[model samples]
Target: MSTSFLLFFALAGSVVAQNFWFSFGDSYTQTGFLDNEALPSVANPFGNPPFPGFTATGGPNWIDFDTTTHNNSLVFTYNYAFGGATIDANLVAPFEPTVLSVTDQVNQFLQTVASKPASTPWTSENSLFSIWIGINDLGNSYFLSDNRTSFDTTLLDAEFALVQQLVSTHSSLFDVGARNFLFLNVPPTDRSPLMLAEPASAQAMLKANILDFNSQLVEFAENFKASNAGVTTLIWDSNTAFNTILDDPTAFGFIDAVSFGTGPGFFWINTLHTTSPANVFWAEGVADVLEGTIF
Candidate 1:
């Protein structure tokens, strides 16, 4: 066979040896994306996306994800998420790398899925897939506005359309074909680093934007399921996830981490991402959702 065929077979062999696990999206995935290193560029300082005009110490460097668990997973897995990326960034303007277009992102997912050999032991049963992007699309605009009007109705309508397109296209891969799909929802941007450091005046303006994004997210997910049939997409709500401890930190059993500032009830290494315990906790949430369903 040709050299390309030889390499393909080698890769297939590796996949056959381990289960199939794939994760996609931006910074949320970045904790597990950057291959165990922190990304200095496209950083979110305050802990998640921010509110309008709320500036922070610097760009986000969410480096506290549970790499040990992410890295430990031996499956033929890869994280193709680029920081500063948004759900609609595919159709709208680009964010960080802008080089890899939105279509390119989708193709990356397709290629990874296609990479698995039909004869591989992992099958659709134990395979896992996840997509966790969408905050930046709305958060970036809100952070720039410094006012409450960022919740422009026109923009939100467009956002919903973008969500529809993403789900529709991605669904084809597994909607009726592949196995389990972990579809993540938007985490509240008001709690992001940008909003955290901003003045109350500016924050008051962006609150609506946060609401818009969340509303659009809920709309999209519900609409998707309502419109489609035989869909097995799972939603991971960091909004609800964050709310659990946002009001009461001690409940989650958090410790203080200087870099993350005051405290979100846990040690956030930085203003934005989670510390090791938190990272693993987030991972566990994903893992739990993936429970026996994977096997």
Candidate 2:
């Protein structure tokens, strides 16, 4: 086992139970967990294929690392992320028709876990809801003929609208006491191997779209927190975290920033996705946020 895994186990004496994590996102966060599958248990919190479930990173993704390795407390993770999910299919179609969008994921949560069922008993105080979407939404539309500015606005409007629905008084989650929320911004995908192969102008456009989307996301999060009472909101700036590694890959123990391979030193595992080490860094950062251990 890795040192981090051993460290997590060693800290079991301080583990606090009943801390639930409801995660929703795309490939970067997917862990192939199904609601009907074997539910999470103390021995195996993820409770599906195995410890490091099917992931796009070629190993464990951020959700897997956060739940098992980086977490300070024992958290039962219910990940509803799919491989090609967008914010909403109506606004931005996924790579596959069968893929469930973030909207679909939220609806799934409402139907299955929102009511505080007997099988997965979760309370608002002990549970946290997180969404790390918009990668596909912007990637699918950034190069399209549609007006980029207007389309980005439409995407975020729909995104925050769903957030509103979750926190609304009439919503199932609100009635069942669901308060904590964490929103992760889109990472610096323009620096990915796929985008590195693109033209300079194309790369610039994609970067601009990412920055705009992330800026609006912060605004929405601030507004949501200001307007909602008794709600805890956090925005994890994943873009900066990815850029920090990309800027100095060797500092993070990566051989280089632009390489793509299924190896320890490579920063990326594929053209568009990062390696498990990169995901581990992300998980550690998020764990710090959740544990209030970072400034």
Candidate 3:
């Protein structure tokens, strides 16, 4: 084999040997992979119900695409995202009480995977923990008559508090040797079909809140990295990605950017969620971030 081909195989082998991704978020990132269900294996990476699992996109969501399509390695994804999760149910309740919040998901991770059990042995160097929340937290509270700016502060405080808990040395993911983290900021939900139908002022308010949250999120991540030693952090700007596709749907193979349907032509599957094709683009973007091709 040529030198270039040999290098490719070497890198591929390293990736295939060890790559575990732990995902946490809401509807946008949910894949319905339960701990009680079947565990992830090489034969069936996603486990449980199948490749796509139960998703909001009407097909495979970003998690599925990331694992199967964008990944150059054999990645076993352990997803703990619920459909209507918020940062904290006490702060902003989910659509249902049973829906797991970010707090609950982290708790679940501690209870089940913190010990690095034999069934899923993952190391700090080989595993990645990703969290993509804040959409529901902001969406459910942005329209409240209460002081919106103060609410955003309160929400991020609670959200980052949980993040601190996760990285703390006592009984947490960091204690279990997980050092890599990828935090995805809230996407442009204000441009979704649901928000588009709202009054222009309402849409503008939501967009403002999103921008505020994303800016604060960046500051928090920078501070977090500064405080924590031996930890790697990455922030993916899903907002910009959403806007890029929405601005030019044709460039991304979508017939309509402002419509919702089950067909591939529509960017969204419902009033609030994007279609699988859109998520494919998201997965690709995430892959780029992971490969260090983009910041």
TM-score for each of the candidates: 0.61, 0.91, 0.90
Candidate 2 lDDT by residue in tens digits, 1-295: 1224335445756654556888889998998888878877677787676878889898888888877767556678889888899999988899889999999998888778788778788886778889999898888888884467677778888887777766665453347456799999999898889889999888889999999889888888888889888878888889999999899999999999898999779889998999887888888788767765211
Candidate 1 lands at a TM-score of 0.61
- How far residue 55's Cα lies from its native spot in candidate 1, in Å, is 22
Residue lDDT tens for model 1, 1-295? 0112123334644642234545556665552242323211112211222211111212222222211232223344445565556655533445565534324555665544433445333455555556676566556666555443344444445544433443454444453134456666666656655567888765655566666656665656566557656445676666677666566556677743223643444445455555445555565565555554532
lDDT of each: 0.48, 0.82, 0.81
Q: Which stretch of 10 consecutive residues in model 3 shows the poorest summed lDDT?
A: 1-10
Candidate 3 residue runs with Cα over 4 Å from true position:
1-15, 172-174, 292-295
Candidates 1 and 2 compared by TM-score, better number: 2
Instruction: Name the TM-score of candidate 2.
Output: 0.91
Of the candidates shown, which would achieve the greatest lDDT relative to the real structure? 2
